[model samples]
Target: MSLFSLENKTAVVTGGASGIGEAISKAFAGQGAHVHILEFNAENGERVVGEIKAKGGKAKFHACDVSNNVQVTEIISAIGTQSYINILVNNAGIAHVGNLEGTAEEDMDRIYNVNIKGVYNCMHAVISKMKEKGGVILNMASIASSVGISDRFAYSMSKGAVLTMTYSVAKDYLDNGIRCNSISPARIHTPFVDGFIKKNYPGKEEEMFEKLSKSQPIGRMGKPEEVANLAVYLCSDEASFITGTDFPIDGGYIKLNG
Candidate 1:
């Protein structure tokens, strides 16, 4: 049997419309998992679902904002009736940039709503079902959670919560056969990066972009698929022996940096 094969598994990938989430969804589908994309963006969500179906993959889209507890609970419950979910990729997140001085109450709350509470809401909603089948949970984290990054106070706090949640869940489900892990990447080349650059440094976008790329010791941004590959391994039974750990897909950012 193929070690990494996810055949017949059901997966829910939050934020599955683009960037890292999209890559994870595609990778799961490629490995024969029936994936459901939980996203708030209807346009992107539909586009991703249609593309997967076009490729003869099994998937569906549910319009959900992970931060919304009622919506998340309803959607996951409905999905449970159709198929038992075996893998969950908590990739749904929002970005915020501000130091402690600049971080406002509203900014922190907004970040918490989507980044931290969003994970809490979704996991709480589906954890009972996950426990039934001995499932896998991979939460998308960031180097920001481990190391200090400039102007990312609220963002760092949220990711820190993600790492801890992974640990707690892993420990809680150890005897029950559920495995939980997290991946912390430094800075992947995603649309969010571009959007940040455009919004923050419009005139000096190229210069700022280059600075961001070179910040990593690898001298470039990590790719979405690079993170996806690691996610694939963790979600597979091949990694059955692993749990309660934070795997860093960072481009030598946390360990090798000066």
Candidate 2:
């Protein structure tokens, strides 16, 4: 048997429209899983599903806002009717750049709603169904989850919650055969990064991009596919013995940097 083959499995990937989430969606589909992408961007979501189908993979797109509990539950419940969800990748999140003093109360609230509550809503919506059959849950965390970073107070706060939630769910569902884990990645080279640099740095975009990439000890930003590869392994039955762990795909940013 192929080590990471996902044949006959069904996967639900939140925020599977772009970047790391998109990479994961494609990787899972390539491995023979039926992927259901829950995303807020209708265009990108539909595009991803269409591309997957064109490649002879099964994929469906659900227009969803993960921060909305009612919407998340309703969508997930609808998906449950189709198949037993075997893998869930919670990759939906927003980023904020600010220290405590710089962060507005509204900013904190917005981050909390999507980053923390979104994870809770998705997990809560699926846990009961997952309990009936063994499954894997992977939450996309950040290096900020464990270590302090400059000007990311709100983002850090939400990710810290994510790491703990991962631990809690893994412990709570151990007997039920649900494996929960998190992936903490540092700066990843994505279109979002490029857009951010272009919008903020303008003529200095390349300089800022290089600076951001060099922040990691590995000397360059990690690739989305690199993170997706680890995700695939974790979600596979080959990793059945693993649970309640946070795998850092941070390009040595968490430890070696210091």
Candidate 3:
């Protein structure tokens, strides 16, 4: 059997409704893993699940506001009892464009709640279960984690914590066979990009999109499936010896550009 095979495994992806999260969910299902999507958006979540099912993949939906501990704990616990949570992908996050001086207190709190605390909550809820079963954890960090991006003060802060948390968790659980890692991606073409364009650029949406796409040295944004392919590799047995590291799937933005 290929080390990439996920035949007997199960993966839980928060924010599995769209973007990179959607791609990861579908890819895991394609690898023969049972995928359960936890997302705040029921409509998009159901749509993704439907697509997976149509392809004869195994998947389900769980409505979630990952920032809410009570909700995350209760739902994850219920799911844990039925089957071991083998692989957990913490992909639930939001982006904020503001520096320290321009960012609002409310906005900072919101970013911390959903971006930082949200990952913490879900990890806390499932870590013990994962330890018992010796599973994998993949966090969706960003280039903001290591390098400063313009007007991303709060976003950068949260992602830095994510990268560290990946290391911290992986270190603490090394003896238990639990592995944790993070993926830092540069700009990717997703609904969020479209929405940002529509809301901010309006008539100049295409122009702004092209600008964002070219921000990467590779001259284009990444596709969700590309990110997903890397994720599937990291979570599979092939990466069993790989952990405590952050994989930058960015288009040479971190190194080549520098």
**Best model number under TM-score:** 2
lDDT: the better of candidates 2 and 3: 2
Off by over 4 Å in 2: none
Could you say which candidate leads in lDDT? 2
Across 1-258, the per-residue lDDT of candidate 1 in tens digits comes to: 686999999999999989999999998998999999999899999998889889989889999999999999999999999999899899999988789999999999999999999999989988998888689989999999999999999999999999999999999999879999999998899998999899989899999999999988999999999998999999998999999999998889888998
The 10-residue segment of model 3 with minimum total lDDT is 126-135
lDDT tens readout by residue for model 2, 154-210 = 999999999999999999999999999999999999889998899889999879988
What 10-residue stretch in candidate 2 is worst by lDDT?
249-258
Q: Over the stretch 1-258, how does candidate 3's per-residue lDDT look in tens digits?
A: 876999878889999989999999999999999998999999999999999999999999999999999999998998888788899999999999888999999999999999899999989999987877699999999999998799999999999999999999999999989999999999989989899999988899889988988889999999999999999999999999999999999899999875
Off by over 4 Å in 1: none
| Location of the lowest summed lDDT over 10 successive residues in candidate 1 | 125-134
Candidate 3 residue spans exceeding 4 A from truth: none
lDDT over C-alpha atoms for residue 134 of model 2: 81
